[model samples]
Target: MIRIGTLNVGSMTGKSREVAEMMNTRRVDILCVQETRWRGNKAKEIGGGWKLLYSGADENSRSGVGIIVNSELKEKVVEVKRSCSRIMKVKLMLSEEVLNVISAYAPQAGCDEEEKSMFWRELDEVLTSISEEERVVLGGDLNGHIGTDRRVISRIHGGLGMGRGTKKAKAS
Candidate 1:
């Protein structure tokens, strides 16, 4: 099976090598990276036989997302979609099936409501656009709160989450 993982790099500058090494050590085939803070929509080879496909805002370096593919699966990449600075997707051909890998960075808790709404709306659009027959692997920093207490949500949460739940988390 293909191993997939997610990471919030904070900023990708000067950290490609470290990221690649971590992936190799963990034996991860695909990694979704967030908060890259890089400006541009492009792909780069970050050594250790890994490739990074990223998308960032042209005017700022605040938000970005990317997907890292190891050498074994790099050649299977068929399409790349840079939805925005906060979202990106890569399609891979695995045998007879298609795998869509999406990397996303949601607005932080301090962000305005409008920005948060837009981020969620855009993410929903991207997710809905894909067909059900295709495989989907979505990973990212969604900026959600599960609270330290798992008594209420034990079925979905594993009791390792930190912090207290906010009104938003309770509403959801």
Candidate 2:
């Protein structure tokens, strides 16, 4: 099975190699990265046969999103869409199946409501554009909270999420 993951890299200026290394060690085939703060839309090779396709504002380094594909999957990319600085998507041909991977960065909680609304609207448009038969995977830092209670969303949440300030299990 193809392994996929996501991360909010904060800024991608000097972290491409490090991110690629981490993905290699983890055996991830595809990675969605957000908050790249990169300007312009372009694809760059980040060493070790990994490629990063990113989209960002032309004039500023603010919200941005990107997808990293390992050597095995890089050439399978069929289409790339940059919805905005905060959202981007890549379509890959995984054998006979089509996989649409999206990377997004949502506005923070304190941001104006209009901005947040626009982000959701754009995201919805992206989701609707994909064909029903195609597979979809979204990864990003959505900056949302479901509170400590999961009774309302247990069907989707699995009721295993930790509340704020909860200690994480140590990796042994």
Candidate 3:
């Protein structure tokens, strides 16, 4: 079976080797990464026979998203779409079925409403473009908290989260 996981690396500099080692040890076939804080849009081999497909705001450190696939499945990569610094998609041919994987990073709670709205709108657009029959896996750093009290928002959270809701959480 194919194993997939999501990680918020915060920043990728000086941590590529460590991340690669962990992926190898864990046998993670694919990994969706958020907040990479990396610059540019490109794909590269980051050692340990792993390939990383990444995108960021620009040529400077900032929000970013990426997908890392082990060497065994790298040949199965059919498409890589870097929509923006906060969103990306990768399509892999898994045997007879095609799997669509998306990596998205939401604006932090302190960001303006417009930024948050744009993030959702962009993400929604990406989601809509994919066909219904394809298998899709979406993962990322949401940058929000569900809060400890789930009764009021039972439909959204299951009450196992810690801390109280923040102003942004309440507003949304």
Candidate 4:
């Protein structure tokens, strides 16, 4: 099985080596990085035989997302799609089936409601477009918290969440 992971790198300009080292150390096959802060859409080989596919707003240093594939799985890449700075997708051609991996960076809790709703709407569109038979994996820094109160959302949460309840949580 492939070992997938996600990280919010904050910025990636001069931290390529550090990120590569972490991937190698963790033995990660596919890594989804958020908040890259890089302003480009391109793929490059960052040492340790890793390939990074990144997308960001043009000429802007704000939101960004990317996916890194190890040398072994690098050749299996089928398609890469970048919808915006907050969302990206990478499809891998596996031996028996295709795997779709989505990397997303959602607006933080402090952001406006419209921004947050838009992020979810975009992400929902992406998720719904994929076929049921294909494997889909989503990873990223989705800012929010599921508190210990599981009775209200037991269907969604497993009752193992940490942190105290927020005003919204208590109200819900």
Query: How does residue 123 of candidate 3 score in lDDT?
Result: 94
Candidates, ranked, lDDT: 1, 2, 4, 3
Question: Model 2 residue 127 lDDT?
Answer: 95
- Residues 1-172 of candidate 1 have per-residue lDDT tens digits of 9999999999999999999999989999999999999999999999989999999999876799999999989999999998889999999999989999999998876678898889989999999999999999999998776666666775665544477754435654
Worst 10 residues of 2 by lDDT: 158-167
Tell me how far the alpha carbon of residue 64 in candidate 3 is from the true structure, in angstroms, after superposition: 0.6
Query: Model 4 over residues 113-163: C-alpha lDDT tens digits?
Result: 798789989999989988899999998988655787666775665544478
Candidate 3 per-residue lDDT, tens place, 120-147, comes to 9999999999999899999898765557
Instruction: Report the Cα lDDT for candidate 4.
Output: 0.88
RMSD of 3: 6.7
**Candidate 3 clashes between residue pairs 3 or more apart in a chain or in different chains:** none
For each candidate, what TM-score against the reference?
Answer: 0.84, 0.84, 0.83, 0.83
Q: Superpose all Cα atoms of candidate 4 onto the true structure and report the RMSD in Å to 1 decimal.
A: 6.6
Candidate with more favorable, higher lDDT: 1 or 2: 1
In lDDT terms, how accurate is model 3? 0.87
- Residue range with the least summed lDDT across 10 consecutive positions in model 4: 163-172
